[model samples]
Target: MTSVWDLPDFDDHEVVHFVHDRISGLSAIIALHSTALGPGAGGTRFWHYAHREHAVTDALRLSRGMSYKNAMAGLPMGGGKAVILADENGTKTPEMLAAFGDAIEGLGGRYVTAEDVGITDADMVAVSQRTRYVSGLPVSDASSAGGDPGPFTSHGVYLGVKAAVAEGLKTDSVRDVRIAIQGVGSVGSGLARLLTADGAKLVLADVNNDRAAALAEELGAEHVASDAIMGVDADVFSPNALGAILDEKTIPGLKPKIIAGGANNQLAKAEHAQLLHRQGIVYAPDYVINAGGIISVALEYLAQRDGEPCSREQVMERVGRIPERLKAIWQESAERDMPAANVADAMAQKRIGRA
Candidate 1:
């Protein structure tokens, strides 16, 4: 079955399609964005789903968010997302990836897929056998440049947090800011490193105590239990964990002056942005702030397809623009006295109009 979430003003569609497999009870969710600006390019994620409804919801929301993220980041690519439900830990197995690859191959080029949260470069290599619609995957040693894009994402978020803090705290530097980060995953760990380098005092928490402790030690940060992060007195609250963490229950308990993070879809709903607004927390829209990975991958995909090589320098400069783009959103939100989410939506809509 397919469900469509139409962004009427933007003339784009987040098409949610589901595939329920007989074997493994594997359900695949595909979100197709048809050329809001250009090709609908995104990555494929494979995960173990507790429920089919959850997968569909994630696909639809992620697809729409990607559209906004791409449009706001000034990328020609539109947005799409694919999810393959399998084991609890996401399949690294060739067989599972092959099945997931087949699902993407069916989408044609309207949705150019790439490496996402659960998928890897090697997995992209597996998908490449099925379709040419995949990106963020280097095909060879010369092109052998595809892997974790987490660091760049963290860098962008770091800059984004800096911008949010500067504007929210009325301070030019992020130095001395107390930042409590939930999640010590790839993106979160990288963000912690950057924040530490910027002289911010850190409080770290993650579900995985080993990783949390490792990262805390690396950054010389203090550690806290994951759920206790919201109560931590801090200048910046970064939710680098899963989405929906900023819902009504959590937002009201937030003590940060500025809220920024690498997590996708930090707000559970549009109203949460207003809640953050009411609390005087400068909420950097997740889509706008954490677009660095997609941007880097898409550019590389374009280069490889067009016979041009992707350079690290160009990608870094592009990633660096995240702060500027976010600053634009922040300023617009302030001037309009609206939620940052609205400003982000408006920015995306404007791009679609231009197209």
Candidate 2:
């Protein structure tokens, strides 16, 4: 078993717990980065990592990112993240979800879990049965405030893309613009629909060929091989699948002038932000652009606390601020000649009193 002390230069997390249940073949990590704003709240990612240490690393990094994300989105929540180590192709039963929920319940509300990556709203529903500290369950229940946050997240990404278009291409509309989307999952599909409605030309790619093909046919988009999507000569490259796609190797192959997507931590390393900046590519900070989900979910959490439920209008009003936030970050980047990632980090630090 790898211990926290064995990790090098790990962030100072408020709490870190390792959970295991041999009976259910469950192995997990929970990391809480902060609680200065409020209880730690973030999503739970279920992925079969190559090693235990890798899962631990992901939890720490994702939790820390959540702290910055929450602060940037003006939410009264800190950062926490959970990861369940399991084979991506393996079965994910309600029993496994309940066990994970039990682990979260042990935290006594210090950490809350939502849906991410392999986790789904149904999984969250299973988790909620074991612990009240879970969100993203089915929103049909009058007593529970949970739902798929993809549309809101994609909405913010859509607005952020337009802001990037204005700054990078000096255009007022995405109509006639070429956008290459690297994923066709929930968030990516939502973004594609919005851009398609606005008359943007789309090139889509995904590992799930059937889904991608159907979406492309529906939207009149051109489909490309998953590996070749990065090299497509589009005005924008939107990576919604996974993180670390903007590293050195792929950066050289990128043909887009704008990098904006719903993926968290799009840059492989913090320094990649500067590399993109030096390359004259407008890289909207991923955390800033992908905040709509958290904003919507956080409002739900807040409403739950106040014994009330937030309306769709109220939630969207807050999510709509993402573009304004991105514009502010862009202005700061221009004035300081700094990368938007750095500007966003500095802004988050200032909000969290680290500046």
Writing each residue's lDDT as its tens digit, candidate 1 over 277-310 gives 8787788889888888888777877887788877
| TM-score of structure candidate 1 | 0.91
- Which residue pairs come into collision in candidate 2? none
lDDT of 2 at 163: 89
Candidate 1 segments exceeding 4 Å error: 1-14, 20-26, 89-92, 138-146, 353-355
lDDT of model number 2: 0.87
TM-score of each: 0.91, 0.95
TM-score of 2: 0.95
Report the number of the highest-lDDT candidate.
Answer: 2
Q: Give the C-alpha miss distance for residue 53 in model 1, angstroms.
A: 0.3
The parts of candidate 2 lying over 4 Å away from their true place are 1-9, 141-145
Clashes of each: 1, 0
